[model samples]
Target: MTPEDLAPDVLTDAAAPIDPARVSDSLDHENTLKKDFVRRVRDCLEAGESDTVYDLVEPLHPADVADLFELLDADERPLLAKAISDLMGSEVFAELNDHVRELLVESLPAGTVADIAEQLDTDDAVAMLEDLDEHDQLAVLAEMEPEDRAAIETALSYPEESAGRLMSRDCVAVPEHMSVGDLIDFLREGHDLANEFWEVFIVDARHHPLGTCQLSWILRTPRHIALTDVMKRDQTLIPVLMDQEEVALRFQKYALISAAVIDEDGRLVGQITVDDVVHIIQEEAGEDVLLLSGAGEGDINEPIRESYLARVRWLIANLLTACLASFVIANFEGTIAKMVALATLMPIVAGIGGNAGTQTLAVTVRALATNQLTASNAWRAVRRELGIAVLNGATVAVVIGIAVSLIFGIPRLGAVIALAMLANIVIAGLAGVLVPLTLNRLKADPAISSSIFVTMTTDSMGFLVFLGLASISGLVG
Candidate 1:
């Protein structure tokens, strides 16, 4: 069944038409549902008043309805879904958090899941199903109509998060020979056209996109004006295999509302709209931040086991690095015995170096993510970071050196600590920038393990430099 078939059934109780004033009352100035409003719904649900729960939720916008689902307890989610089954439309499903949606979907029947998927755009449908286990996915596809199933199956065949999977099959494409007037007439009469489109793609007989014309351009053109005459010859054609992040970058760089997705032979297969790219950009940005901290997804609703596995592995790696740092300190036990002040002052040097390294690491990762750092300018970026590092090192060293000398009255000890601080901070800076650049060059996501290595380098080198310097500077001897 088509999405249109499901639209008429959603929020159609005309006897109780939505009141804008009541909808506003449910939300606060921040746009989130008011606490008392949520509490009332929970009370009704607990009292087993399904009709009352439905009444409370019916006036909400689909996105607000989605937020309500997330705010409810996990068990209450299935109950809420049942109470407002009609209002659980495609838009609400599209707005639901991924983990919450997965849980709510699993409680639903396969037929119900298929119906919801059919109502969504191709990309949203794929996102809904991609997280399901293979058996459950097959079951849902089995219940779907042949045409919808075929489109989703084809999208699933592509790599996850690729343009082929993200692009919608519904788009306006016409033969290059058509006039603007002819295209307009055809669009008015077409029964199965896309629900929303920004531009008309003009294509050759083989369906290779020749150019594109905005809707406004067609409407203002004379009837006799050929489409090719008005269509801009240049276009950004996204390859089907291109990653979604790259696709988002292209859209942003070109300020595009929509772009054609082309297959291997350069034939237009589908189109990706700005709405889809907006979601991708948000997801990718969050994903990079979470990965940098080794907290996979960092989503509160993620399964406990999955979160544990993702975090424990990173913690274990950190533990190993900490051990390596400890090994450096172990080698200088006698140095610390000769001067106990060395023990007290060593941690200060390592801590400052770590903070400096983290600052550089965050900047480098962000630059690489946004494509600001590249092969042509990588050397320049390295030099820039090092310059900043040296300035930072000199400034921090002077302050700590003065403080140590004033408090302890040991000018020689202060001098040793100052030199060590400057050395370690410079080393931290080098490690921070070089580690990520090296990982990027090796085709690895620099955010994944760059923090771990940079931390290790700062910690180990800080201890070794400070203790080794103190032992040889005649302060300990």
Candidate 2:
């Protein structure tokens, strides 16, 4: 209809003042999902104005709304979910924090959860159910429609954190024999296609993925060309049993938006999208860092008892290592008694060495994780670390040497400590690189317990070298 034929009051309706309280500022660059928005939603909920709470949150992105769920107190999550039941779509659940999502899911009925699972991509649906107990999972699955139930059940049968568990079952795959025109027409006529796909997998008669045809290519190339002719032959296929972290690395290295996931027989079963890889990358990166500190998953929403259990066990292990350093100190009691300056300067040696080791350890673990450090080239990595250690040792030794000489007015003491510092720092670098590599060779995670062992080595050796030199040189006595 022409503008004149439209409703006479359209302009007036368009110009109506926005309700300040109901306005969604989610799109405004400045109006981020901060504490103020959270407080307003909380206030609205507390006042029993569930509709107002919904209005306040309706403008947020699914990820932002998920963040809002995290921002809420645990008790309030269910209340807010009740208030925004219609708004709690699959996207919101997909983006929700694992802990928060589980809490909400547990509060939901089996049928409702099944419905949500049905609405989500297979990977996300699997993630939602992955944490549930066998009984709870079965209940949810029983409530689901048969097709979705079968897809989820098959995915759950794979080991957790594997490509099979991470991939989306709803992929767009077509026979290789079709022409580009035929593929285009089929895609246009298909009603049950995946909501999101970057490329269409070209498959053989046996349903084995042969290659991929990117959407950009499909749209640009002439329709008369055979699908196999225009499709890229060099496509990365993810093994179903491959670890999720490896899956992410492959995505990063290959710059892939989506890759076909294959079974043992090399038959295409599902696809892993880049969006899921992003989550896996973030999880693995954080997991390694927390593991280095002996901290278990280090999730804030973790129960107090669970957090304590994860952290305290490591602290106890650290205590045992601390005693080994103490044993070295006890052996040098006479040396410290003769010159109290030895007592004052020993900790500086140990502390700095520990820090140096930690720096190297972090780098080594990351390189190993990214496949940058491997058996054939490990020696090269070691030599590079040794060079860095030498530079670090020289810098630290010179500064500490000058300070000791000036403060103690004993050149021999300074010389003893300077040489000791150099020895310990070089030892730190060696231990840092060697420990993680050893752990990796043993098929253990390099990040886990590496920090503790590295600290112990630095501390014990720091005490041994400094005290041994001080005793032998007769600088203190």
Candidate that would win on lDDT? 1
Stretches of candidate 1 above 4 Å error?
A: 1-17
Q: Which residue pairs come into collision in candidate 1?
A: none
lDDT (10s digit) by residue, model 1, range 1-477: 222322323432233468999899899999999999999999998998989998889899889999999898897887788778788878888999999999877777787888889888888898899889999999999999999999999999999889999999999999999998899999999998988999999999999999999999998999899998899999999999999989999998899999999999999999999999999999999998899899998998898999999999999999999999999999999989988998899899999999999999999998898888999999998999899999999999999999999999999888999999999999999998999999999999999999999999999999999999988888877
Off by over 4 Å in 2: 1-31
RMSD (Cα, Å) for all candidates, in order, is 3.2, 7.0
Which candidate leads the pack in TM-score? 1
TM-score for predicted model 1 compared with the true structure: 0.96
Clashing pairs in 2: none
TM-score of each: 0.96, 0.93
Worst 10 residues of 1 by lDDT: 1-10
Per-model clash counts, in order, read 0, 0
